[model samples]
Target: MPSEHESFNTRMAKAMNDRDFQAYEALLTDDYVGEYPQSGEVIHGPKNARAIIEYYPGTLPRDTLDLKSARVGATEARWVRTPTFTVVRAEGTGNVGFSAMQSRYPDGSTWWVINFYELRGGRLARSTTYFAPLFEAPEWRKPYVEQRGPTADR
Candidate 1:
């Protein structure tokens, strides 16, 4: 059987993939913080967190996101996976992009995000995301970058 932490992380990932902000909000702590990497800006509280999700449509290509693996510690969980984003340009051009992200779940209730994405455009066009931690003083954790697969895995 999966642990409670693992189950929570799975549900969170599913909520993101489904774009169910309501469900996502339910999983968040009362005071949630959302971090955006491109601007290195942090959105504090659930209100800001909801705003970030609402405005997400304008930021990147929207597609079904898949959550691969999740690892949990005493009070934190890290999800490692690549999401396929279908990028759409204002000019009606569209393409698929893949980016790796590590989402930390504090208290198994809220999720703090740290993600890096590169669009077809230059570095300035890239996007970064950060979110609030569940604990009083959240520790600094590293982001998950994609690694080359072994021949057998490929």
Candidate 2:
């Protein structure tokens, strides 16, 4: 059986995937703020609820359900709002975050993603993630950047 923390994370993910605002409301703190770092968008309260409803199922899933979420503000992992449950950072026990390029689906294309979540009182206090499809850098910018990490196989 999953621990309560583990189960909480699972429920929130399901709510987002299923676009169940009420379920999410049950899991997220009433303040519930989500940030889209790439676009500098901040969604809060009822609007955040709407994002889960109108945005996820209606818009985001059409492109990628695997995308990570929010920046979590005060919050800004300066280590951000003190995470409570994160699958990537603390393996869903506490504090979750990861930046990786990986296959989100079996035999599917890879994506670049970063995600972090914070938990408070068994409910999500705040969370954030960013996602981008993998692509090769053009020759034009190669000289301006230094190589880093093990290169991903083409």
Candidate 3:
């Protein structure tokens, strides 16, 4: 059985992977805030956070379910989209949580994303996310380090 913290992380990961904005919003506190330091953007409130994803230019992947069908209450299980993000890992203790993810974009690029979260009353009160494109390790560093696979434990 998953611990309370693990369950919370699982719910968060599921909401993000499904892009269920309504569900995502429900996981956040009314005063929730998120920051993207790379872009110098700050999202205030759950509604605005949802808007950021909903209105992102060409970012939303096309769902397998037809738009008309979706509007008619088609099951989400029938929905499919490409370039979805995968939660590499998530863990939490007390009021602090952390998640690492790998995102593949439609442009054939992959990026690593990390989010540090602060929870209040079991809902996200603050988050800071950082995104970085995957890059090949420099040959010079090979001698000094051991390569770790995706599932390698910290």
Candidate 4:
């Protein structure tokens, strides 16, 4: 069983992954703040969650969320009509962008976004994130990369 605090963080993460702006907004504290140090972008409160959705643009295809766990239960379909809800997500942060090749970043592809969160009052007080599209190590870098240790034959 998870504590309420852990549950809150999980809900916030899920809302972000699902592109469920409404659910995400509910998880933010009144003073919630999000920052991208690489990009020097700051967004405050629940209103800013929209920016995330706009930039990602359904970037996360499959959603594995338990909406019932959220602090504010907003149905996916109804939230669309709410004015605050925007199809916004973060754009390329600093030097990073979504993807040049649509084929490479297909609907269900994995683009990793790592978030470091600080919780306050059982809600998201602040969070910092970095995102990058997943890719195979290039042939050129393989030489510089460390090789795995040899293992006994299975």
Please provide TM-scores, in order, for all candidate models, with all chains considered together: 0.39, 0.49, 0.75, 0.51
Candidate 2, lDDT over the whole model: 0.52
Superior by TM-score: candidate 2 or candidate 4: 4
- Report the number of backbone clashes for model 4: 10
- Which candidate has the top score in lDDT? 3
Residue range with the least summed lDDT across 10 consecutive positions in model 2: 80-89
Q: Tens-digit lDDT track for model 1 on 41-144?
A: 86665556655654552222234323333322221344323221221111111222223333332223333344432223211123345444334322343244
Model 3, TM vs. native: 0.75
Between 1 and 3, whose lDDT is larger? 3
Compared with the true structure, model 1 gives a TM-score of 0.39
Worst 10 residues of 1 by lDDT: 84-93
lDDT of 1: 0.41
Which lDDT value does model 1 have at 93? 18
Q: Cα RMSD for candidate 3? A: 6.6
Question: Scored by CA lDDT, what does every candidate get?
Answer: 0.41, 0.52, 0.71, 0.50
RMSD in angstroms, candidate 1? 19.1
Tens-digit lDDT string for candidate 2 (92-130):
545443222232322234455455667778766676767
The deviation in Å at residue 83 for candidate 3 is 4.4
Query: lDDT per residue, candidate 3, 9-59, as tens digits?
Result: 678766655667788789889999999999999999999987766554333
Pairs with steric clashes in candidate 4? 52-89, 53-88, 53-89, 54-87, 54-88, 54-89, 55-88, 55-89, 55-90, 56-89
All models, RMSD in angstroms: 19.1, 12.3, 6.6, 12.0
Which ranges of candidate 1 are over 4 A from the true structure? 35-38, 58-154
